[model samples]
Target chain A: MAVEQVAMSSPDERITLTDDQRRRRRSRSIAIAVILAGLVVLFYVITMVKLASTAVDPSL
Target chain B: MAYVNDLNATEPVPGVSLATPRDYFELLKPRVMQLVVFTALVGMVMAPGSIDLFSGAVALFAITIGAGASGALNMWYDADIDRKMARTRLRPVPSGRVAPGEALAFGIVLSVGSVALLGLAANWLAAGLLAFTIFFYAVIYTMWLKRSTPENIVIGGAAGALPPVVGWAVLTGAVGWESLVLFAIIFLWTPPHFWALALLKEEDYRRANVPMLPNVAGAAVTAHRILYYSLILAPVGVVPSFIGLASPVYGVIAAGLGAVLIWKALPILRSAGTDRAAARGMFGYSLVYLFVLFAALLVEGIVARLGWF
Candidate 1:
């Protein structure tokens, strides 16, 4: 019974869950991470575009 | 106008919150400060004036601090509406991380400190503009216009657009058409940029009872307004190049981007679903537009200094 209880707990206390629960949590985290990463990339692109638009001639 | 939050006396404290120092800092709205600092720096750079490294640094610091002060005061005043909005719910006063009184005090201190620093490091003209900018944003924009009308952001944009003017003043100790043109660029840019955001977050504004364009006007009207403004913005963007502050290179780019902006806006006016994509694209492009325009001016200034022009 003790071994069974131990088996029920995942190794990662950060997300203590059954195997199925662990799998779902992991997927959700990946999705959120991806979204955040995408937002960061988008922000970078916008910044670069802003920098590029302003080239001017010396006379002007 | 609600300089103090009604809920400041009533809301329960949050279990999860930042420290007092963090909350105070948050009240300044760092992102807005960043915009203010950048525009002001660009204005300083593009102006026909000279400053040693130390004085220039001091001037920039003063302007940034002044911008931050305005943010603090805006936060101090808007704590009530902020508490009501999910987006602003986590702000210091709303979340009970910092007391309204503390935020108010912080703003007042920074406001005075920034003005004094600018006056000492730069000149009275720059200092005066900084003071006016703070008042214009905190009092005029936040305290008065924010809750009064749907056109609040439109009119309030002037305060946001003044940093460059303030920078120009710092360099020349006077105003000129060039700085005014820079001001005009931003003044025109603000409506379309914010209207798009307002269109996207109409529900949030409605819940908060703020009179953002989308909440006050129907979607169709808001879309029309966006298109109308973009149409104006498109042509006006080319003026800097014509005025000799920028080159024809900037002119061509501005014209190209302006056309795209107008194109993006057309579908938004015709239908609501397209509003989001259009708004997002416009808002994103608007940043690029201003950045490019300023970069052009900066390049012109640098080249002229190097005797290349």
Candidate 2:
């Protein structure tokens, strides 16, 4: 079931999202959220690897 | 605002976005990205020395996203021409599923993000190469050459060829001689492969006013050029064996594939631009030739890595 949404397109004007638009927007939002989470994990792991590499190599 | 009917609304509405996650993904030209990732991986595998598994994976990720960013930018810039071509008419920007501004923003974000991530995850050389590749494809090729010149695919092929070099740089932290051989193979392969498609899509390109080789120089010239490149490519494809990057087995296979490519090209040349079937056959085998040739190198790389040599 697609849920319709009420969004403010302007300060004085209200724009309504049709159910399908709302559904697609929700999916897009979810995808973005997931990708952001993946990036966070990637950054964290890469940082740890870099730090560990530096720790093992002291001759800089 | 969504002014369209609420029931079963599949079409995009003005000022309202109906684009799904899939439509956004389509903007990246995933098939092209697949080829990019594959070739870059082959480069990564064949380079001297070894990269840690995690770092290599991350580098590949960066390259993949960078390629996608370029694809998105190309879609945004080429939307008008894309709309005019039947093969590309249904692309996201041309179909109105994704807005041009959205694609541009998506591309820019991914481009920056990928470069930064690559710099952090690997070395700066690979990151720089990825950034340059994106710029060449998006601005140099898509925004400039494609609209202006018939040799667009030829010069633009350089951007596509750089992936392996970038891949090599990722692992070795410097571009290797072996990688240039990889680069040359793809660089030379691009014209024949594209011109063959141009033969079939001559009308589409001409209707769009794009000066593809076939549309500008005529099909006979294009076929002759294809023969010339095919002859050069067959020998170039076997260069990796002498360089010790590929095994003799792979070199033989590359030779066989190159021979098949030439055999396919021979028919096109003999047909004198009148044969669509010959062009199609050439196009189809070209794909197989590159795939198997690369797959063989990948296999040899894996065997060497695993001490199976």
Candidate 3:
């Protein structure tokens, strides 16, 4: 029955995704967002460290 | 938006449409960018002065972006010729995945942003070299020499060779002989490497009217020239060891790889324009030779820092 329904769909309408595929895509998107956020925080911390190091006097 | 009305507004959106994230990334020519980044990193690691991890990362990132900007601009300008070439027909601009205007804008923005950020993160000298590299590739090579001369790759190779120099400058704030040697190796390697590929793709370049060496000078002359360049490239590849920048191991490996490169070129020369496989082999081996040579240098640098060498 599922094969018959799939065969009946037009080529243009064949892009429909299964529930599992949609869930996987949503998980991928969230993973990417988390990674991006982590990178941003890392950059911020590095910049702060750089600034703090530059502020210290090396002669002492 | 209403000012430009068309009855036949289509799905592809008739020029001035949104591009996918992947399409924008494709405009960067990631493979070329990888080489640029790796060479630049090697330069940074080999330089005398030390850079903190954050600053080094920033400098490398800026160089990567600058290289990508140059690639995008080249794609934008060469869209017509690219459409004619089988290998480049599917590029973002030529394939109509990204509009030329959009590409130009993207490139310009990244070029300025990268240069400015590099200047802020590193020194102006490194940033200046980065700017010049982008301009040399986009304007001097792509706009001028590529269509006009058979010696295009020879002169244009300078832009590609500057990344290591720029990398060294990022830490030292000035160019040095060590970086110059790296630059020389790449500068000399470019002709032989590219000409080998051009041997195989001569017809495509001829069809596009690009005046590549094989297309203009005939394949036999091009093959001979590749051998000529390879001879010079071999010695230059080993210079880093003599100068104390790399270990003797690197020198030996570079010499062996260089000999193999010359050996690969020999078949192309003897084939008398008939050996497509020989040319392809030379092209493939050239890439591996460069990667291995540089990787050897990187390992030498690491070992030296660890005081194991």
* Per-model TM against the reference: 0.77, 0.94, 0.85
- Scored against the true structure, residue B93 in model 2 reaches a CA lDDT of 88
TM-score of 1: 0.77
Ranking of all predicted structures according to TM-score, beginning with the best and ending with the worst: 2, 3, 1
Predicted candidate 3 versus true structure: per-residue lDDT over B104-124, tens digit per residue: 998999899789868867889
Local lDDT at B23 for model 3: 73
Off by over 4 Å in 3: A1-47, A58-60, B1-12, B15-18
DockQ of each: 0.02, 0.38, 0.05
- Candidate of highest DockQ: 2
Once fitted onto the true fold, the runs of candidate 2 whose alpha carbons sit more than 4 angstroms away are A1-11, B1-14
lDDT score of model 1?
0.78
What 10-residue stretch in candidate 1 chain B is worst by lDDT? B1-10
Which of the numbered candidates is closest to the native, going by highest TM-score?
2
In candidate 2, what are the lDDT values of residues B173-285, reduced to their tens digit? 99888899999999999999999999999999998899999988899999999999999999999999998898899989999999999999998898876699999998888
Which candidate would rank higher by TM-score, 2 or 3?
2
CA-RMSD of model 3: 6.9
Which DockQ-derived CAPRI band holds candidate 2? acceptable
TM-score of chain B of 1: 0.91
Q: Write the per-residue lDDT of candidate 1 for residues B1-309, one digit (tens) a residue.
A: 112222231243232122334456687899888888888988888888786566677788889989999998888889899988888988877776566777788799889978987886678999999999999999999999999998998999999899999899888999878899889889988998898888777788888899998888777888888888888988988898888877898899889888888887887887862458777777787788778777776777778777886
**Can you tell me which runs of candidate 1 are displaced by over 4 Å?**
A1-60, B1-20, B272-274
